[model samples]
Target: MPVDQPQPAPPVPPVLPADVELRSPRPEDAEAWSRFLVAAQRDTYGALLPAAFGDDDLAASRIAALESAFAEPGDAARRIAWRGSAVLGVASASAAPADWEVALGLVPAPASRELDRLYVHADAHGTGLGHVLFDAVVDERPHYLWLIDGNERASRFYERRGFRHLDERVSTGPSWGHIPMHRMLRG
Candidate 1:
């Protein structure tokens, strides 16, 4: 089914109106990105992970995954949305893993980009950062993201934006609880 592209919102009064810059992440951003994850886990995922995973140490590891995507010379990018020194959000894509390897079987290959992780700081929630990042991915080409089921706010957000359910899968674990979900995207 063809989905109607959601319209972007006009700029409103952003909490931090300082010159917003969306650029590549650098070594200096390690601390800021770590701090951002504190808010990410607390707000987005509800602090469901262990203390070790939710702490600052995990930030470097998470950022490393994103950095690896950019490690390659060409056709890869890692963008960190910033308001001055603060890292508000991040968006990156890599060679899509095979269908079975990715969550919800989102095949990032064959002319598609997989939105591995698109997160915004809690302070910036509802400021349209998610929409902005998603638009960036969709505009790139065939793109996909797996929305876990129990995350209603996120699921609804994606649905409202035009992602449709391509599948219903369940994931279970202690640290990574069951995430029943639908896969949605834009072309």
Candidate 2:
């Protein structure tokens, strides 16, 4: 008889804290949202795209854009993760624009949706806030997103949730110091 080999334990999923709540963006949230986004981006992408984060004017412009988007969300659906009064993370999804598809050389699908943004504060990383925010926006449907080319942590998270690289790339232009990004899709 062959000896039995020990099997590895299944990976454990992170558990969201009971106090956390997810809600739609409100006008009152603009300032906190802006600060959270700046801090989160600094923690997440500062090194990968230094110039963008280092520029105060650029950061201000981005914050203004975020506030404007919150006020007039248009076709996008957004969610903000909160723990009491603190903003923990944010996410949004919207119909993939035809121009974006064309630019990426992708054949547009009628139901194609884009995961516009998903940012979790560093304090919430291990508390399952990311997963909660992700599911709240684009749970398991065919959707796509762009990520910084070398974001290993986000890549692994998306890969585990069924997203795969489409081998397509884009640039953020000079405003962002020409940071490179790759597309990922889940179908």
The number of the candidate with the highest TM-score is 2
Residues 1-187, candidate 1: write the lDDT tens digits.
9999999997553343447676666665655665675567556666555555455346567667545535542554456789866688976554456345555454443335666667887777887776676555445466666666667777787677666666546463344444355556656
lDDT of each: 0.61, 0.78
Q: Pick the candidate with the highest lDDT.
A: 2
TM-score of predicted structure 2: 0.75
- Per-candidate Cα RMSD to the true structure, in Å, reads 6.5, 4.4
Candidate 2: 10-residue stretch with minimal lDDT: 49-58
> In every candidate, how many clashes are there?
1, 0
Model 2 misplaced stretches (Cα beyond 4 Å): 1-15, 50-74, 98-111
lDDT of 1 at 73: 22
